[model samples]
Target chain A: MAMSQATAAGPRRNRVLNGILVNGTLALICLLWLVPLLGLLVSSFRERSDITTSGWWTVFPHKSYISAKQDQLTKGLALDKPIQVEGVSLTDDQLRAGYTLPDGRKLIWANRRARIVDVQTSQWTTKANFTTANYQAVVLGQTYTYKQSDGSTKTEVGEDMSKAFINSLTVAIPATVIPILLAAFAAYAFAWMRFPGRRPLFAMVVGLLVVPSQVALIPLLRAFSNLHVNGTYLSLWLVHTGFGLSLAIYLLYNYISGLPREILESAFIDGASPFTIFLRLILPLSVPALASFAIFQFMWVWNDYLYALIFLGSTPDTQVLTIKLANLIGSRGQDWHLLTAGAFISMILPLVVFFSLQRYFVRGLLAGSVKG
Target chain B: MIHQTRDAENKRASSAATSGWIPGQFFAGLLGVVVVIALLWAGFIYLRAARSASILNAIVAIIWGVGGIGALFYVSNTLIEALPQKSRDRIRPFLFFGPGVVILFLFLTIPTLITLYQSFFNNDTTRFVGLSNYIATFTDRSMLESFRNNLIWLFLGTGFCVSFGLLIAVLADRSKFESLAKAIIFMPMAISLVGASVIWRFMYAYAPADQPQIGVLNAVLTSLGLQPQSWLTLQPWNNLFLVAVLIWGSTGFAMVLFSAALKGVPGDLLEAARVDGATEVQTFFAIIIPYIQGTILTVTTTTAIGTLKIFDQVFVMTGGQYGTEVVGTEFYRQFFTNRNFGYGAAIAIVLFIAISPVLVYNLRQLQKQEGF
Candidate 1:
């Protein structure tokens, strides 16, 4: 009783000790978790000049400066030349060539002995000459060609991110929703129905889960060719629907079957038709399951570079966000700032999805774990 | 007596059973049979939909036999069966589930069986050259690498992601910012696998040949006074690097599942342990873990199965370069890139065989939860 009460009531020492360990671990993990995202975010805000001049970490506060004046001198101070550096540089030629000194007499070297030369040197500095030029390049315009105010040619390249973003949403929302909607109906049937070949039907759906979507590509292409449904959102939607249906159905089946049988039966007894029962009883209740699959399908379809690349790649207008973003990676993804910003843009939908429907994800996972 | 007995049997056969419960079951089974027949009829109709079938009346013939007859059976049965008595109670669920079954058969099953047949065919799928494509799958250099890399990916990638996810999930539980912390880990789950691949591609970006390396890792290395390294170009290891993306994308899923299980761990049990003088760590291990062990197993299997089917990321990122090939991507490459149908199908079969145990385990686990 004493021990129990002591542990429950007050444990200044234990609380302090345990608190330190837990909080430390939490802080460490959070920091580790945020590192990559922080790297990407800070990198996105930096200008090309700033990126070249200083690290992203150095961009925020420190007001260090890198100054060089080729106009002031030719030789002794390596403005464009070699030797002296670190803030203000002094040169004898500046004293000789141009301005008068504080002294009344003009200053010069011993004579016109040393020939004046252009200041040219390897100039490298890591200081705070940062700007928001990278962000500017993203939003309004860039160095690419566009029609100008006077109707003459001007290179005003805007961020390609916005259009690709919309394009992705157009392809993704339907691509994700279509398969899920189609698959949910399929999953419900596979779970609760008794047909002549129900087991075989389900086994095939599950079997298709393992059959790589690639195996179907040629056949699909040939089928599409024969049907002449190629090169449209409908074609790509069909492709995503076909590819995603098996897994979505498999996932939803796991949940739909688990719903209390009585609720469905009661609905049936209430003189409701199958469609009515599904809409009122099944669909609303299956929101968690549906949302989880929606999240998966949405993310997959959104991030889908392959299907989009293969099916939609025949035309530029149909390319999705992933394909667009990937191509922006220089066919290799070397443009860091654009990559980061583009990543953020591409991820916005999923993040909103995850955060908003996160509770369902939690529920879905628990159900998946505890039940099966 | 024979006539009376036969009449009784006929009446019994029309409904579920002699008992009330069996009527719904019987009706359900009858409904299923009707749906199967109707769908087959539709296919029979489409098959007969040839433009040459009685040329002038082909449209009329196609419409009359297929959808028309199928609808007739459906409507007639539905109207006759409207009494909604026992034995026929199952018809409701069957009605709900029937459309899904037909679609699954048409889209998923037919395509799969066709692949099996096509797997034995020549390059263009016209002529049957038995086992030739399968033979080439084993011999080709790319196929061999793909197979080997897939093996590596299946074992190592799945293993690491699940374990790390479990470990982090354990850490994040009972924290002040559990939701916030989870959101960070879960954030990556929302990004498209290809989007993530694109993001990571920039992280692995390398600039050589007179260019100062601008990639973040390189910049960090240079800042820390170390030489830069080309990360992705590093072969065998690069596969692991690519696998990291799959890991990143999947861990959040694992974490969410585990966290839910953690939430279900029963707080009083941990409190009891603490009162019993067990340390916080000891209490966590002893009390909290056993309750959620089933959940951990489920997450591991889910992640493992998902890992086996990784295609889009590898396809998007490396195009399976740097020894990063997995079965899903390999199957596609062979089917599409190499134009070898049999080889691709064979590879898919191999993946199917590889994943079957995992699938069975998952299904068994789910069934156990549902008590089916």
Candidate 2:
């Protein structure tokens, strides 16, 4: 009894230590986890040049710099000619630009490197500049004028997602609705209907759940072309519905089959036809399951790339947000601001869906994982 | 004569109710289904014939898509109602399960068979080359590199996602900010893999040492007086870099699952262990972990499956350059870019074969959980 009492305080101390260690580690990890997302969010608001010149963390009070070299001054500096730099006269040819003398004035040069004579210099200073210009450019397409490899300037509209957003809706709404409708019916049958092949068919659905979509891609495309539906939104609608059916049916069956068997049996005894039971009783009670599966289907279809890339070729009108965002990276990867903004734009809908329907999202995930 | 008149009156009364609702339901359903099909057909034509940028096409497509599927279900139910009662009883399950089964068989099963057959043919799918394509897939240098990269991704991505998820879940359990911490970490799961790639690409951004370093990793390195490395160009490490993106995107899913499992761990067991003078560390590994071991295996397999099928991050970030190719991207390249249909089909088959064992194991686990 004395020994037990003595160790009580020691246990309390250990509990306190455990508390701090656990919470502290979790807090640190949470912060680190947000870093990459933060980088993108911050970079999205920065100017293109600032994104290229410094890290997104350094967005506040950015300092511009200009460096000078000795060889450039010797090659381009004219003897006995006065050079004007940031309203300061440089009479000496050897001084060059970006030279900090013993005075308060520090000479800097243009942001770009050029010949000494062509390098117009300026005063170095800090600017707290931030802009929504990148977003604006993305939303309202910018006509970019860039020098071509053939030494000709070409003007083209930068890739934007305003139209692709509509395209995603076109693909996603049907994709989500079709699969759910089909799966709900199949689930109802699998759950309540008396069928000879129920167990084997359900097993097949489970098997199909893990079939890699890659195996289905080429042949499906060929079939679509044969059906004269390739490169159409309808094609993707069918493809997604078919591809998603296995999981949808599996999830819905899990929920629908578990409904109180007594209620269904009683309805059957009351001369309620299977059709009426499904239309009236099963549909209403299955709303939560339906909603959860709908959310999953919507999110998956919205974020889908491979199907969109293959079926909805990257034509301006047919491309979804994901396709546009990907093509933007492929063509103009160095434009970090544009890339980040475009990425965030693509994420906006899914994030909203995720946050608003998080309960269903979590339920659906649990059903998939815990049950599996 | 009096009995006949009374019977006629009763028959008339019952028929009046059926005539009122039955025809109205059938016509409305038929009209809706027809309109939906018509709109979809027209929309497909417009997409192909006109510019894809038309908003009208998108709107029409969505309306037809969402409305059409629902209308089809209604059509079948109303059709059953319009039938003789005996026929209706025989056809109800077909109405429920037919559409889903037919779509799956057409799109998934048929396509799978076609691809399997095509894998035996040549690039143009003309000559029957037998297993030469599969042999090429195994023997080519680039193919070997892709296989190596996929293995790296599978191990590193699955390892980090499950372990980190478990760690975070255990640490954050019962913390005051548990929900908040989990929400932030879970945010990336809402973003597409392409978006995640864009975010991480910024973190691995690099510039010449003389120039300002924009990438966070490179920037941090230069600040520490180390040379900035071209992260994506560094072989072996480049593959790891891509794997990191998958880990980042997937950890949230694992964490969510693990957190739920942790919540299900018996609290009384922990209390009992504590009363037995077991330290928190000992209790954690002994009581909590063993309880959630099933979840750990489930999450690990889930993540590994996802990692094996990973395509978006690598497609967007590296394009399989600098020895970072994997199976999914390689399939895309061979099929779409290189136009090597046979080789692409073979690569896809390899991916499908790799997933079968995992799929069987997952299904077995699910069967156990559901007790079916």
Candidate 3:
């Protein structure tokens, strides 16, 4: 009995150790993945000065003191006499150099100004670390007044992202809906109709799936220019629909074809026309497939930069979020406060759709990749 | 019974073909088509006029795009149904397939062929250049750099994404907090690559040695007594840093695919292996790995294709500066910035050639699946 018990305990311990190892590795990877995004999120809420001067991770509440400027403590005071701040009297020499506060805080004078550092834990709150000003600046545009070298004031307005946000929606919704509708129709035909060139046409779609979109860029740009639609939202919608059609058709075909034949056969016997059957039966039953493709196409169109860059010129009025955000990166490379907020704004919609409809998205991804 | 019903349906279809077309139905269908076209035209005008970023404009665009397309399809189908049955049967499939086919041909097929033709021409298409453009693609200094950098991105980016994806997928399987862990890792997939570039740019932010390092990586390095380094401009290693951004953004995609594949591995097989006294690692290697080999291939090829065409990250992050040029950026620079149409087309074609093997392999896989 003792030997058996020892053996059981050994294996049980090994299993627990194995579980710990696996979980630990995953936890680390997850943390590593989250850090970049989290840092950006935290930085987006920070003041520009703070973002430039310190790390975003430093925003958390910690055992640190707060410092007040000398002017604040010495307001309306006589500097010739001994200065008392927070019940601590400072000698003239100590005031010029540095002194320790009675409450375990340090007082220092640097750059000809007095500074009183509050006691440890006196300012441990995280509240001061965050602000929504960056977001406000990005979405609503902020104005700044600067004192010119000639002693005049100059006011400047920041870029507003609201137009780009609207442009992205205008592009994505139509691009997504058009392709899904067109692909659903084509998928129904490919799955059920007995057309003469059906096999080869579907094969062409499958072949086109891997054709790099790079090959189409220059020629399409030239074509769109000739047609005079180069900078229009219509151009992008059409381009997205065309490029996204193959995968959309392929995924929907896989789902629609797998549907049981009995329902369709019975509908035929009831004298339902092909169009009616498609509208009333095939479509209703293929909602999941349609949904998956919709999510896929929507995300693809929303995140696209190259096509929008080429087709929908980077005019502020026509640029999508991806283009606008990229331009921000270019124009404000050093402005992390603005870049972070812009990045987060661009990501919010896709992230919401991804999380809320993640089940359909995953199903779409699996269907696209893992065919039986 | 199925055969009898099919025969009756065919008879009815043929009989309908013999029946004369109804003028009333045809005219009504034509009127419906006219109405849809008018509605679409009006919507397009409204959308073009209301270029301002207002909520009302967004609402109109959404409704017009979604509802107008629905109307078009409905009317198109009704028009087809009003035709003589013989003509209707012949035209019906095209109604479903025509728009997609036309768009694909216009946007994908014809443009690809045009790009091929354009590759044989000079910068302005004023002179024929033959294989000179292709030669430059292979021999130019910057093009060579792009090729080398592309290779690095392909191997390291694809390698890290697949390995980490698999590792995380295997680790997170059945673990507590599995969904949360997966969600954190997968969240990046929803973000635009431009947003991702912004995130990593912050992660790799730099400052002078004495200045506080705001970037998290540099902050850690400095706190640990190391000199702060410029991560994005640090020579050949900078390429790896760029690739790291791709890894961070795409590993989630690979992980989701692997998780689904891992789940498909049967439990009974694992139980049998364990019962045979095989270790968990041995079972995983011998059983699970082999079981999901197809998914592994799919993930590898997909990620490899993406890495080869990697643009937005490299474009936004480094702007192909600091020796981080890839094919996509090179194509953009040549085509748009420098106006080297032939060179850009050649580079685009080179990308097509590189991706062809995978394309053929994917097609062959589809054909094989069909054969089964």
Candidate 4:
């Protein structure tokens, strides 16, 4: 519409410029928006050494050699010609490491831990060397074999998110479901029922909506520790349920109150109790609000780091995906392959929920923020 | 015809309804609620006492929490059925409102009060050291840095998210590929902050000048023949790098909301503006922006509140290293890692105080939206 306005008012030349400017800006911003995700996606399939050796974009160019010179190796070298290993010609003194061969085979040195690459692929290849090894290493907690200083190989198990993934599910599912049930029931009451102090009570619930979860952390952690539920799935479930309550009630109340009172009044005249009206009528009619809140709660609990870190602690058995992922960043900071794959693993479910239910998700955002 | 008939019937039915009165069954429903809660707690304890928890225990507890709560509502409904009809009406609200309010009070309100009380004490909370912890929060170097970084996060993070969101919304509107483009831009909102951090970490990934830079930013710089910089470890600026991650996630959210708001801006108004000989730019600035002012304020306030509590990005990327600390992560470090409870409590309270004004404003907006 704005573009049409521009065309109607502006000179023809300016109109052409505006079209290019608007489309180009949107395309550019969209690309910028996607850059990090693109980086992560590309990095996930790369081998560990390749991930560390070059940018993910370089995977397209396919010049895959890591060239390093070591003068120590030159002292006793007698060869005059350059040393050609896998089509990568390195001077006799130079150490050519982390290279891919002409046939696209990678030469890995166990002791030196370097990739041998050709660095000479000129033609545009239709194929790429993508591996799920990083994902395998992350999901299955695969072991990495490292050579000791004494020349023996030792395998150390990588930090796997399998158990933490389970822990996250265990924490998130009950946390999400319990709050919705409680909130939906409460919302129905707040919306339709006449009760003393209902207005002030709903106001109080709304007031609590903005209480930063930070203030609750220290005291709750101390209390949970005393109750011996600090690191348990029950504690997380309970806390998430508590934290999600106010918004859940608010959003659900907004939706339920706007429902046709005729349905409830008719049900009441039919000898159905208020509880029956809520259970059979209100709940069914309010599914959209319930679903939106459920997705919000589920995503919040799943992606939460501070609560999981503090309440659950960083113990291997009790850690959730966020805590584990953060730890992975700390311990294996340069292990981009692992981080990328693990990041995706952590995000996959939320992404699926978001895309599949984007309409509800956006509706929830609007209802929770601007209008209702 | 149906709408008018229903409206008349709704008014007549409402005016014809009898005045509500409390019945003795109300007390029975109230008693049933307490009894169910007690039973649920006992069941939880019994489950915990039976054995040290395994995955099976977690699953069973989840089932108990979700199913038991549902059963409690059902049982309470059945108990209320024995009450006289009028009493059941008065008591049903209690049954509905009980569980959710109780949880919020127990977890959020009560803990927040305890946290406030603990802030005046010493680290172990044994000795009274009134104002010392609060003083330390302002005087301490890291805490001050965190405060400063939080301010930057609030401004820059909210600013970019709102601005980019508005820009994208305006540009994408009425475009042929609007939905597709918006979907791609909105993709990152689905990712957890931890995942976003990992993704951005790869973008800011740095290798020494000798190695090919793997991070997209550093790679771009290197390809431009500039020195590769360690984006995360660069002092002060690393704070902005961390903020960028939040902006990346929030912009999509703001954009979706703004796009919805833009749609609410009437087409006839824009036509009126154009007919008055207003330029496209003038129309957007005068008419469109003002129309979406409420949405803009809401997005900005919410995003500002979120940015004030920035945690996961700083934690994952730098672990508050290189002077990138924010209040949330600082609270984590002091409470969990440093084992300084009082300081942590103080920081939490400080964050609470900082967010209170925003919270009040948001509540006021909600009230206004409710037409109160």
Candidate 5:
């Protein structure tokens, strides 16, 4: 009895150790994956000055020790009154103009709070730093007043992303819906209907699956220009539909063909015409497949950058979020405040759809990739 | 027996057909075609006119683009039903499949052929320049750099994604928090490459050595008593940094696929190995890896294709500067910025040729599975 109990205890201990190892590894990887996104999320909510001055992880409430010169201390502060630093009283105007400290460290005021700086470092504690201003600036235009070298104030307006958000929706909806609709019909034909060259045609689609879109870029650009449809939403919608058709058809075909043969045979025996049977029976029965393809197409079209960039162009009137965000990275490379918010805005919709209908999305992925 | 049943169904379909309405049905079909064309044209015009960013314009475009296509399919199907049985049978499949096929031919196949033909022409396409563009693609200095960088991205990016993905998937499979862990890792797949660049841009943000390092990476380096590095501008190694962004964004895709493939490994098989005194590591390498070998290939090729066409991350992060140039960016620069049509077309064709082996492999796999 003791021998059996010892053997059982050994395997149990092994199982416990195995569980810890598995969970520990997954937790580490999960943390690694989450940190970058978490940093971006945190930075998006931070004030512009804070983003430029410190790492996003610093936004966590903590005590910071840092040495700063008087000029460096005055940069982000908006002082309202005179303050005494190491027995020297300094007014707001004096601080703004320039103040020199004997030891290059002094008391500084920011956001109506004062902290002492030492020759080595200063002790400053902060609550969790947070702000919604970055999002406001990215979604709604923010105006900045800068004093130029000539002492003239210049007001520059930041780019508003609300319009680009709308443009992305405009591009994604049709680009998603049209291809699925067209591919559903084609997939049905490929699955159930007998036609000449159907086998070869279906094979051709599978071949087209790996044809990189780069090959079509130049000629299509020329064609669009000649057709006077360059930089239009219609052009993007058409191009996306064409590019997305093969996979849409392939995934839908896999599901539609696997549907029980009895149902189709019974509908035929009942003398229902092919089109009616398709409309009344096949389509309704194929909802799960249709839904999987819909989610796939929607996400693909929403997250598309290359096609949208090349086909739609980056004009303010037509650019999608990907194009707009990419442009922000180019023109405002240093504007992390705008970029973090813009990037979040661009991903929010797809993220929402992905989380909500993730089962269908996963189903689509498995169907597309693991046929065997 | 199947052929006889099909013949009987055909006879029944013919008997149910309404005769003596040929001209009316023909005109009705013509009218349906015209209506579809007109509706599509109107939607296109409205979409083009709504270049201004407004919620109202977005709503209108969605309705017209989506609703208009829906109406076209409905009308075409109805008109086809009105035709006599002989014509209907001959035309029904086309009615379902025509639009998708036409779009594919116009947007993908024909344009790819045009790009191939244009590759033989001069920059302006006014003269034949046979093989020069191809030679330049091979011999050009910048092109060679792009090829080398692309090779780096292809191997490193695909390798990291697949291995990390396989690791995460395998570990998560045995955890109680499987869904949540998988969800967090999979979340990045929903983000666009542009958004991912922005996210990592914050992670890799750098400051001068004198100032506090704002980027997390540099901040960690400084805290560890190391000199901060400019991750993006640090040549040669910068390509790896950019490739890291791709891996971060795509590993989730590989993981989901691997996770699904892992589930397909029979529980009993794993149990048998464990009972046979095999260690987990031994079982993983001996049993699990071989079981999922096909999925590994699929994930590798898929990720490789994506890396080969690496554009958005490189464009947004480094703009292909600091020796991080790849074929996708090179194609964009030659085609759009430089207006080197022949050269750009050659680059695109080169990309297509590079992908053909994988394409052929996928086709062969599909043929073996479906017995085509």
Candidate 6:
């Protein structure tokens, strides 16, 4: 280990500085990673109006309010002497600026000359208010209600992105589940099952790994359309499955094959059928491999736009998260806050999934796939 | 001990194994009858033959859907019996591999044969165009450009991802803070491609003439008194920028693989080098590199293959805009978007052909390592 360390780099002090540089670089990276996420969380709290006008970070300590002069209608507290209104005591110029109104009237732009009236109060007192409306707009609410920076009340139509969020789930979960289930079984066959032409069959699948799925999209779509499966969750789910199965099976095969042969033999001798061995013995032992591949396939399909796009279309109801983000940009004209917020919204689930499952990655997938 | 266990298991195994093929037993006798009936159906279609294409398409579907399933099972079970007695005990495992074979054939092999046929046809899908499709792809400016850019993708994209990933993995190994640093670097891997594209879109964001650049990188450049640049829209450079995203995403994969390989390097080898009074840098070049050479080669090959077929990032980021077309992205654009089946097939062939060298090398290396 020490020899490997020496050849790889210098001693501890040198490594320490290298470590500092790496961590510093990573810290900057973390900040970079967090910006979009931070923007989302901040955007969730901010009013649509504020989001459009200022960056999310500008929200705190910036003190945004419309200020105006409110004439104390009763002659502005006339003193006992009732001094003549010399120079219009406390003239409009002296009325001071920046005030909020108790009536919830926001001052767009104010000048001292404006005065309060029964029907119209131009005199705006500084009003600083915060509400949970933005949160409602994002989670379990609407996309259109979010205000634009250019002071436009933008409204989204037809299927809400949130519905597509569920639609994405409908596509993603099945696309993920079906392939892993199939692959786990296939991987077992490739790994432990004694079969004629096993190598060729496994090779065919692995060789397909290099055969890009982009090649199959059109024909598959045509086939699906002919089968009346086009534009259905079933279509995209199958597309993901067909595309994912090769790699997933290969990866799982490696992990399963790497397991000690004795356990499997023991199971076989106990009269446990193949299915029984897989269910009771192999499956539990292969948890780490399964988790890693699950993370992999989940992330891949969840972020996938092409398969979903080609098979599912731009139909708002069937759009996956990727398509939704694409539309948000194309239609909304780069509403940064909303895009950031929406981008982060789509990512939260994947992040949690990857972070939680990443620990299992230590098992060395490639180890089994290749020989020592 | 083994013999005693084997007899106990045989009683349990025989029943379970036979039960698994019970459906096959049921179908075995009926298959002959069904084939005769199916021929009659085909003959009926042949006689009506006015709608031959529709019938032909249906026949294709049935062959793929039904015959494909049957073929897979028959092939799988037939092969199962051919293994030596030592390996024959793996019957229970073969059952799981059944579905993977079916999906692989249905999706990959059949489609490949179809693509070969399609490459000979015209855009309308009715006329055979011979070698003209492949010829036009070579002569056409856009197709040629996509090929050139894909080479750039293969060389530079995979090149950076492997080198940088190896650099990071080597540095992070044997460190106190290894896991945390790796986690942060791997964070991008967790994000969906869309989310990463969105995050990067902000980082590479360009606004019209006078707008303040919101992308962090551009923001920094402007802050540094340099003019803001449109990173993604820059013709040649945009390809590299897109590649950067791939590097960020795939480096963790390379890192983890190399890291695992690093673990397998024995410590005594390194200690011997140290006792020889080898300098730190000398030790790395002399000892570590050679020890982990197999893994480095594997990582490089895997990453190279990955880059050869990259589509998602480019498709999402720029849709192959600004002369940044790659084979994977261009194949989709040609076949599906433009409805040009011949050109798409030609490009797909090119990609498959291009990846063959690396594939062969990887296979050979994998075989040599595995002693298969």
- Residue-by-residue lDDT tens digits, candidate 1, B313-349: 7777777777777777877777677777777777766
Which of 3 and 5 is the better model by DockQ? 5
- DockQ, 0 to 1 scale, candidate 6: 0.25
Clashing pairs in 3: none
Candidate 4 ranges with C-alpha deviation above 4 Å: A1-17, A61-127, A144-156, B1-35, B46-59, B84-88, B366-372
Per-residue lDDT for B1-372 in model 6, tens only? 645645554653464455543344345535644654465456334423222123233344334333434444444443443333344465535556767778788877788778778888888679988999989988988878888887887788778777776766766775567787677667777677777777677667765435555555665677697888889888788888888777777777777777777777788988898899897679878988898887877777677777878777788778888988877887888877798887888777777777677656655554663514
Per residue, candidate 2 scores C-alpha lDDT tens digits across B1-372 of: 434533543453345345633566567667766876686577567644543544565566555555666677776676565554555556778778887888788877777778888899999899999999999999999989888888998898999999899888887785778988898888888898888888998899888988889888998899899999999999878988888888778899999999999999888888889889898779888888899998898898778888889888888888888888889999999999998898888888889899989778866765675434
Q: iRMS of candidate 4, one decimal?
A: 4.0
| DockQ, every prediction | 0.24, 0.45, 0.53, 0.47, 0.55, 0.25
Leading candidate by lDDT: 3
lDDT of 4 by residue, A1-372 (tens): 998987877677876887788889899999998888988998888776667655677667554334232212323344467655544665533443444555755443322223332334334432256887777788998876544546587666666888878878877877888788889888888887778878777877887887889898888877787887866677777788889999999999889989987887886666555665676788889899988998988899999987888777788877889998988888888767788999999999999999999999888988898863
Global lDDT of model 2: 0.79
Off by over 4 Å in 3: A1-3, A63-109, A112-128, A144-156, B1-87
Interface RMSD of each: 9.3, 3.5, 3.0, 4.0, 2.9, 8.2
Q: List the residue pairs that clash in candidate 2.
A: none
Model 3 Cα shift for residue B235 (angstroms)? 1.0
What would the per-residue lDDT of candidate 1 be over residues A136-245, giving only the tens digit for each residue? 55444354343343458745444556656666666666556655555666677666666555665666666566555554665666777676556555456567767777
- lDDT string for model 5 (A31-118, tens) is 9889999988888888766777778787665655454543224443445666555568787655443455676454443222443233
Cα RMSD (Å) per model? Answer: 9.7, 6.7, 5.3, 6.5, 6.3, 9.9
Model 6: how large is the Cα RMSD against the reference?
A: 9.9
lDDT for each residue of candidate 3 in A1-372, tens digit (9 for 90 to 100): 999998899889988998888888888888899999899989888877778776787777655445644334644456677777657776657766556665666665543343432332245655346788788888999864434545587665666898799889988887788788778888888888877787778877887888899999888888777766678776787688889999999999999989999999988777777876787788999999999999988998999998989888788877889999999888878878788998999999999999999999989999997772
By DockQ, the better pick of 2 and 4 is: 4
TM-score of chain A of 3: 0.82
The CAPRI class of candidate 1 is acceptable
Which candidate should be chosen as best, given DockQ against the real structure? 5
Fnat computed for model 4: 0.67
TM-score (all chains, Cα) for each model: 0.74, 0.84, 0.88, 0.85, 0.88, 0.74
Task: Report the CA-based lDDT of candidate 4 relative to the real structure.
Answer: 0.80
